[model samples]
Target: METTFVGRHVEIAQVARLMRESRLVTLTGLGGVGKSRLAHRVVEESVAEFPDGLWLVELACLTDPHLLPETVADVMGLADQPARRRAEVLAEWLGPRRSLLVLDTCEHLVEAVASLVDTLLRAAPRLRVLVTGRQPLGAPGEHVYSVPPLPVEDAVALLRERAGLAAPPDGSGGEGGAAELAELCQGLDRIPLAIELAAVQLRTLPPTVLLRRLNDRYHLLTGDGGPVRHGSLRAAMGWSHELCTPAERLLWARLSVFASGFDLEAAEYVCAGGPLPAGQVLEALTGLADKSLLQREEHPTGVRLRMLDTVREFGAEWLSRLGEDSAVRGRHRDHYLRLARRCATEWPGRQVEWYGRIRAERRNLRKVFELCLADPQWSRAGLDLAGTLWFLWVCCGMSREGRHHLETALRADPGPGPERLRALWVCAWVAALQGDLAAARERLDQCRAEDPEGSVTGHVLQVEGMLALLRRDHARAVELLEEAMAWHMAKGGVLSGLLPCHALAALGLLAAGRPAEAVETLSEGQALCEVHGEEWSRAQMEYVFAWAGHVEGEASGALRHARSALASALGFEDLSLSAACVEMIAWAVTEEGDAGGGAWLLGVAQAVRDSLGLPRSGSGIFAPVREQTLTQAVKVLGGAGFDTLFAEGQGSDLGIAVKYALGEKIS
Candidate 1:
């Protein structure tokens, strides 16, 4: 939206009209035809009718078909719950909304995208899907629009507009330069990316000289692969590649290792080395950005650099040609591995910042995980990475994805080692959370049998206690959790392990009706969290405090603590904790006699839970209290009145609901 958009009025109007008539529309064209850009502009213009939200999913970075749902969910700002099919959860949440879902560059995953789009469309009747790809997905009742190349005149305008940044165009050639410019656009097949790539050359090349160079460029890259229509892009890309310095060319090739765009630090670490020194990477990157080979996106933290898919593909081919693909990939794997360790180590504080960084690196992380699992040498690294990110899987909303990665790593690299043992423990914990108790126990037993030194005994005890708590064996859960805490203490304080231990122990106390003990138990966790500046784990303890306070009829205390917990929970993107906090908030609100507000919050909580596929397997223990809260709200606001308020909350977007829950004034 920030860039100056050239003319596409006819295509834009056609796409918008198609969207009005069809729930699913696919824009098909050659690689550089600007389908994605057109889709963005069309959606921006047509967003008023879709009140729920507008989500754009970029599929170019996703190679594995299985990750499609998770990728889409990530774009939707959701961390999927474990056990429930991600698609089912997505549909359940979207079933009542009017949202626009845009899938860009899905040509590589047509079948998978088609299936998912079909499911969401069927379930969310009000949902509309607009897709841009090289070809149509062929979904039933799909409207396919073949996006033509930009008109030669519009392409000339774009080239002129783009070239204007450096200097005004020369109006000296053949009838106000129209002939020369149109020839350039036609030579480039009127493809926007190719034209833009050539337009930047105008800063150095005169229009006549550029048109002459295009002839040589076309013959230069003759017989190259791809549709004939894509020749302009390939030639334009080849010409640009030829023009770049050696450092820039090598940097471009090496930077292809990143699954998505990356920050400067990443480029320096991963793309620098060999001919291109680390010190020179920034300059080369700047050159590439200047040439329009890389796109610079400014974020709150810094500027991110990304290559268009077509350009990246060209670089990838060159990376292979230079026989540096494997080596670059290894470097990439190591860089992200170090990043993972840093994130784990620094997670004591800055939990919110950690979440942001992790969310930003999600696609790259997935790429690294896949690479690790696919290669034996990196199997241990994969297992280690998955195990180390337990906070992401357990505390954040990624239990399902965590479980998948852990399971894959476990199967890929089977052995008796620290990484395997930890992966086993983490996998069991995720399993227990997902309600697969049998698998959870099996993995826990494997940990004990394989871990001869029993280093993870504390972890084993904690998860076993969690299973017991899930089974409603409160006394047994309390005993085992205390034992786990004792084990952690004897082991010289597994601080990371101790935090969750304390929270679970407090929950066991509260579940067993010992609210006083729960409060006392949580105070220690609060102190521990404060000592370390731990927000995520501390948020969990706060939720337990809210729970204990509510159980003891301290509605005001519950409300206060719930508010604190929900804020941090949201910061860390922990929807499970958010749901728990919101439920506690609703309970306190209803008890304080704002039954209407409580009823609305209750609806918000349920909708969030359903979106997460909550109240499943491991989390059904709170059903009783939830039912009681619902009944109380219904009594205060009669059944019909309650449904109206509840539906209102359910129908609201996650952001609006979160704002209202956080005390923002909303109708």
Candidate 2:
């Protein structure tokens, strides 16, 4: 192997040592400090010792907080496992195999990463995880190696390499020129990022003249150090900013309003205010990309753009300095508000093709919420945003952020009226989803106290009933669902629409213990989904079908239904449905008396959970059947070990099983 590390021998050795001694090694450092570069080098050098191949999962492109694990699973080439249900599979696959899993750039998804690493470490005794990020993964036995910048001489040497220049002559400069240049580079931290940037200018500008220009205190010198701040690479980002064109700088400042990566339309909408023209957004974006400031990637949705944390920080600082924060935030807020309204309007029909599209835009929605909350005047706008996202938040399990924004909006003093009712109902619904049963009941009571027969009260009942079903309060669930349906029907309400149908299906299935009947009822809701084109309905209906098939002892059929459900699950990026689907598949495979297949499916499901960074319930329709099937399968597959069976790849292939069970080719 060509060991081409310019000057990171000490860090590399430390990482290698950590890898040998510890189960987890985390290389935490600022961006551009070569943390990723160093980790890659170490893995390449040491990976030959492991039986399993080294796996690298780069999380820089990950924007959705909930899908971090799923992304990892995807990178590992395991697509059959449903959302948040792959951890066990990952652990099972790695448990007996000696392997190194390298997770790169994990700051944005810290919690999920922590949970996943924790699970994998516990399950796989020999597997080692190497993570490079701004912060540590914070797991036990975690060996954190902080990567510092290169030493001055080494940094200058590397810069020269990148700049394609020979070493400067000793005393070639008169007076303090060499010292001045070195001092400038030192202030920039002798970081590889800063030195390389300064080296670039060396093609045209002499080190002395560049040093002189850098001496001016006001203008940012090209030489800036890379420092890991807030567990993110923010400091090195400054140097990249100092090298931007005026137009690019302007665009960079405005683009900070985005919470996650965005498409071109978003750039035109938010970054196009003031001097930056809509036409120039793409030009500026391309400029940034060329400079290695912004990352451009092709997503399933579209070509999306992203920035490093440090770079985004610098952009935000510039935005603040230019006093464009408020105006740009307004545009961001306005853009998402319009988007929410559009999604809400179309949510009732077949325009539902855009459900996943809208789900993907949730980061922008969060940014809008922040903007709205910051300016009291925009609280009404915040109300609209939160109210519109009620279904997504409650039904889709974004209750964490949804409830947060709802409370913030409620406290912001938006005037009392029907809109207030909407916000109140959302708060109640969020509380219920969060399992704050007391708070949910209190909020519902408050809404009813205000107007017992109001539209908001109906929503409260819907959530109450849904919560009841979640807690297995089947009788209470039925009562609440019935009351909600009656209230809505009496009001002839079509606005808080899907809740009634969802409540109906949930109560019917749970009470009747008839998954097939529940599927039929939920299918009625699908017509509404077809009319509205909302994907949540599709996901909900899939849940019903999967559960029903599992209950009816049709494991093969259940797996088929679960696979079909995944499109809608992927559409909404909903982890719950993904988990449900995977659980069902695992159960179904085991039920077919295929121990090897069940084990493989279990491992696949665990992989999904690991990728999702969470646990799942196996009590539902598919879960119980899956457990029973797996119990029998595990006995049959346990010769030397289950891991051996997994390694042997002896499971009945999913393709064969699908054909035998569903009478159709699996997508």
Give candidate 2's error at residue 246 in angstroms. Answer: 3.4
Top TM-score hit: 1
Residue 18 of model 1, lDDT score: 97
User: Backbone clashes per model, in order?
Assistant: 0, 34
Best by lDDT: 1
Q: How does each model score on TM-score? A: 0.95, 0.69
For residues 265-365, write the lDDT of model 1, one tens digit per residue: 88888988888889999899989988888888876556788988888888988999899999999999998999888988888777777767776787899
Write down the lDDT that model 2 would get: 0.66
Clashing pairs in 1: none
Local error of candidate 2 at residue 536 (angstroms): 3.5
Candidate 1 C-alpha error for residue 660, in Å: 2.7
Runs with alpha carbons beyond 4 Å of true place in candidate 2: 1-10, 22-32, 36-146, 151-189, 199-208, 217-245, 347-384, 394-420, 423-443, 467-496, 499-503, 506-523, 542-562, 582-667
